[model samples]
Target: MHRLQPLANGLRTDHPVPGIPFVDDSHIPIDDPAAIEAVICREGGASMGRWERMNEAQGAWLAYTADPLRPELAWAVRHHPEHGRTVLLLLTKDAPLWHSSWRGPKLLFRQGGYWWDGTTWYRPDQAWDATCKHFSLRPVPDATTITAADILDENARTDGGRLLDVYRFDPEAKPPDSWNEHLAMWASQRAADARPLSQCVVRLSAPELPADQLIGVPKMPNIGDIVAPTLRTYIARIQRELPAGDG
Candidate 1:
């Protein structure tokens, strides 16, 4: 139906669904209730629903528009009260986009906020007037609709497992004792391989002497004479070894 689905169980279809002009000014209804129902039925029997959260005084409106940049793309919308201004939600109605191959009727809670009007593609304003005009709209019903803030909070709560999968975190890892410890552990896991202080050790080896020659021990250099003595000793050792080979 070009008309909206009856409001039931927290969802009301968008009425006077936005229609887009095609090849010869003939428009295709963008939010066809039957097509929406077919999609819902195909995808595990989910509902394409809207829930009103604010009255007309709060300046929220649920809208729909075909994307100008990608004609195949369509959007469901809800205006939100942010601070003293208004914001728009490119809504997904009943399920997240990820659920139905990124085509579910997910409602816009607070994330996935992209602004649009039928004529223009992407915008960032609350822009109720511009949007309504662009889509040939009337006053949408006064009811609670989904907002970006609601979805954002839901995403934060529900995305923990998905994030863990993205970074390949060990699911069985124990909770860190403190926040600092947690940070340190995370850094250690991600940083490059380094030979640790505990693994480093110094080894000393004596110079090999021929069995026939008497071993002449050189005096150790004091800290003050370390550089000079070290150079002298190296030179003397090389000279001595050369002469012995000549013999």
Candidate 2:
């Protein structure tokens, strides 16, 4: 959102929610939630959400935000208390948007995620070619009402079968499973007459969306490299924006 200046450009925040105006650059401590830290939750701007360790004995830390201004979606992050990479999740309460896309798509977890274009629901891997720089993804859904519980839901899934999507160029394959499978199945049907794999376009299935009713994820504008100076500016903005707490 232009309301927030450089933050609207992803050049200003460490975590930028792609479609929404929210961005979080808060420096939450990994070792202890109670430790002195900088938390930025501006009323009209960026928010990191209320955070705490998900489990005791130094387990995963979580940050969750349920923006009242935008009720259709929620944002969360899960990372080990120490030495763990953060995983960002964008959760939605929009049934029409979620149901229109292919279900059971996996991201870093089993049985989660969705992929969609303007018209069709495509699996993640087969959704793009080697040429894709940015692709569409919906990480979690099925929340009737989003709250702190949504972040808890993300950590509850099995960490197995991490299938975002698969590539299938095989010609003699069985019936189609996904976009990749559909392509191969089409090629196998043609046998010798089929065009080269590079030239083929998937017919796309479960066509359930014009997606006009879905939440608008504003396309990200490239703000160039996030160097030290920009980051310092980011932190300063957070400090400058959020109202200081009572001592």
What TM-score would each prediction reach against the true structure? 0.17, 0.22
**Which runs of model 1 end up more than 4 angstroms from their true locations?**
1-56, 83-247
lDDT of 1: 0.23
Local distance difference test, each candidate: 0.23, 0.27
Off by over 4 Å in 2: 1-48, 66-74, 91-108, 112-247
lDDT of 2 by residue, 1-247 (tens): 0111111101111222222222222332333333311233456755434555444224545444433333333333333423232223233232122122212221111101222222233333324335766344432232121112222232343232122211211111221223233222222333363233332221222233223432211211123333422332343355332111000
Clashes of 1: 23
Winning model by TM-score: 2
- Could you tell me which 10 consecutive residues in candidate 2 have the lowest summed lDDT? 1-10
Candidate 1: tens digits of C-alpha lDDT, residues 147-179:
222222222432121112212222123222232
